[model samples]
Target chain A: MRITIDEDKCCGAGQCVLAAPEVFDQRDEDGVVVLLDAEPPAEQHAAVTEAAQICPAAAIALA
Target chain B: MTEAPAAPAPALTTRRAPGCPFDPPPVTQELREQAPVTRVSLWNGSTAWLVTRHEEQVALLRDPRISADSRHSGYPTVSASFEATRAHNRTFITMDEPEHNAQRRRFTGDFTIKRMQALRPRIERIITDLLDAMEQAGPPADLVTDFALPLPSLVICELLGVPYEDHDFFQRCSAVMIDTRSAPEAALAASQELLDYLEKLVEFKAEQPGDDLLSRLAEQYLLTGESTVDECAKQARLLLIAGHETTANMIALGTCALLQHPDQLAAVRDGSPQRVAGAVEELLRYLTITHMGRRRVAVADIEVGGQLIRAGEAVICANDLANRDPEVFADPDRLDVDRAARAHLAFGSGPHQCLGQNLARIELQLAYPALLRRFPGLRLDRPLEELPFRTDMAVYGLHELPLSW
Candidate 1:
């Protein structure tokens, strides 16, 4: 699974981090999306997908 | 394209069915089924489109053409007081991007999921201390006063560097601020009083900085000319009111709901952290405290659910109705803690979603289990129907929850 985030669109509600903490994190300075792993392992696919689907801002896109 | 004049629309109301305090007003449910995107009259006799279905409501919330700014003409406000106070109380939530995004980002770092999670120990300590005090005072305590209200109030005060001792004063002002029934003058006065209080605090923080949000705002935004003292205080005022009021309602109302559902109560009390987290989501969905639909104005024409909403028309996204939509959750009205209910619109959806949601979640996850575990015999002291629910306020909750152990 591949992940990309739009920092411009990110409102930092942090649902992505809550859903897939290992794959995502927020910048401490502004809480914008910080991509921890662009290409996550297969085991983390479901959570990463859920994170994308539930992100309020639609900031996280998964491919 | 001439059309016949339409009949006057029914007025939107805050009335929940008698004895079913948890449910949205029956009219809203009817509208959801019959006309998901239909016009409704506001309190001012102005008409606004009411979007009730989950699917369409989410779409409208995400639509950039819709404006959250209350200052816009024909904006559907909750009450005259809300209309009267809008000019005095505008915050980031009321502004549109890219300004909204810029203003909101300044404080998002402090409320990120990770930062809130890191405060778990401190929050747990607050819960424990409050519970200890409640126990020492014995049974038949007003949980709202003794536990639910203070837990969030204390945490927010410490975080914002506001003195907890002033809770009584601030809480009183906030009460007036949210009460939809308050006269316009009273509402304006209350908000001005809060803004004045916080402005003084911002000035003090500038002089003697502390390791808190207010101090950070003073040093970073206030001094840098990025924001004025009034602007800083307005933001702080928003945090102060929102940080406590919404969460306090959830804590009290959620506890009341659990006491009535013994089996669900047991699950929350004996469940693991994951289980408790799930329960919190379900409870938030089941008892969405923000019963007033999210109000907005359509700046551009948009079609939703087969209806064309024209520009300059006001819209009310009835989130409570959306949260209870049967299409989203089977047996939509049931309080099933085990359900995968994380997609709920309790905090709303889109760019204007609640910022303190992560912090609220941490506080609730710790508060519920701690309270239940500490007092195994905890139960409501009075019947649910007899409790004074905050129906008059913009946010739905209990005025007081009488509890005994």
Candidate 2:
């Protein structure tokens, strides 16, 4: 799956990072999500999906 | 062109219905139905937009134009005391954008799900130990003082490197700060007391750092020159107060609510991990203990729910009412432990949603079942009406919960 984040909508609640740290990292400056990998192997797909589901701002989108 | 008739606005009242202690104020329900985005007169004689609909609240919280900065003119204050203390060193909660995000990020690591999960064993130990003491003390215990309050207070104290023994002092100050009826001078005094205590604690941590949140903050913010010692202390003070009070109340009030619904309480007491987690979320929704509405100001003109809120207009997002918005949760008033209730605004919404939610969740997840499992016959010692509830405080919760097995 390919993952992307809307920087403006990221609320820095940190749920994304906790759920899928391999795929998502927050910018040090403002804590906005920083995409670490656009596409990950099937092994990490569940984590990515969970991250998106847990995001309060709905800033994460996966295809 | 003739102007249409404007819906009459109901005056905001904090008093919950006479005996339905678990429900939101009666007038709040009326306003949610009649005028979800109507103007209500506050205690200070200032009127602000009181948004009650679940959809409207979520939209407003996410809108970039809305500001949570309490310093802005026309920003709705909970009371005159809140306005007086607004000028005190602002916590990240009251900050807007860039600054808010920057400050909030500094401590997010400590509250991340991984971190909170790691702390679960420690939190469980705390809960177990408290229960042991309560059991030792025998039946007819005031659960509020004995179990509910101390569990969170001790955990927070450990996290921040603050001595739990000093809880009485800090708790007193926190009570003064959040009490809307408190005098302005008293509020300021409380703020000063907590700030001063935190300042000293932060300074001490700088010299003798430990593996705790305050130590990390001192190293990162104070020692690195990213922030002043006082600024770091102010942030610590805010966390210290919020870390304990909100959860403490939730524990106490939640127990009271669960006892009222024995069937639901049974599920929470004897359920799987998934069931317990869902129960926690549902309880958070049903008893949105933070009854005082979130206050904000519009930095730009925004039209929502067929009403145009001009720039500088104040808005109060009443989460209690929003949580009960029938459109959001079917039979929103019912406390169904198994329902998918994670979307409730108990922790709020948007960028400024609660920082310690994951930790709070774990605490509740562990707390509810443990308490019930230990004392299966737990029941209120006094009638519901006789128990003291914190109606006047900023956070809605029971002041003292008397219980016996």
Model 1, B383-403: lDDT tens per residue? Answer: 778999988798899999988
Q: Candidate 1's C-alpha lDDT?
A: 0.90
Instruction: Provide i-RMS per model in Å.
Output: 0.8, 3.4
Indicate the worst ten consecutive residues by lDDT in candidate 2 chain B: B1-10
Per-prediction DockQ, in order?
A: 0.81, 0.36
Residue pairs in steric clash, candidate 1? Answer: none
Q: Candidate 1, residue B291: CA error in Å? A: 0.6
Ten-residue region with minimum lDDT total, candidate 1 chain B: B1-10
Best by TM-score: 1
lDDT of 2 by residue, B1-405 (tens): 112237554577789887899899998888788766888888877778889898888889877899999889898888878889998958889998878877887877677666677889999999999999999999999988998889999999999899999999999999999998999999999999889889888989999999888998899889999899889989998889889999999999999999999999999998999889889889999999888887899999888877888899999999999889888789988989998776688888877899888788899999999999999999999999888999989888988999999
Query: TM-score of every model?
Result: 0.98, 0.92
Model 2, DockQ value? 0.36
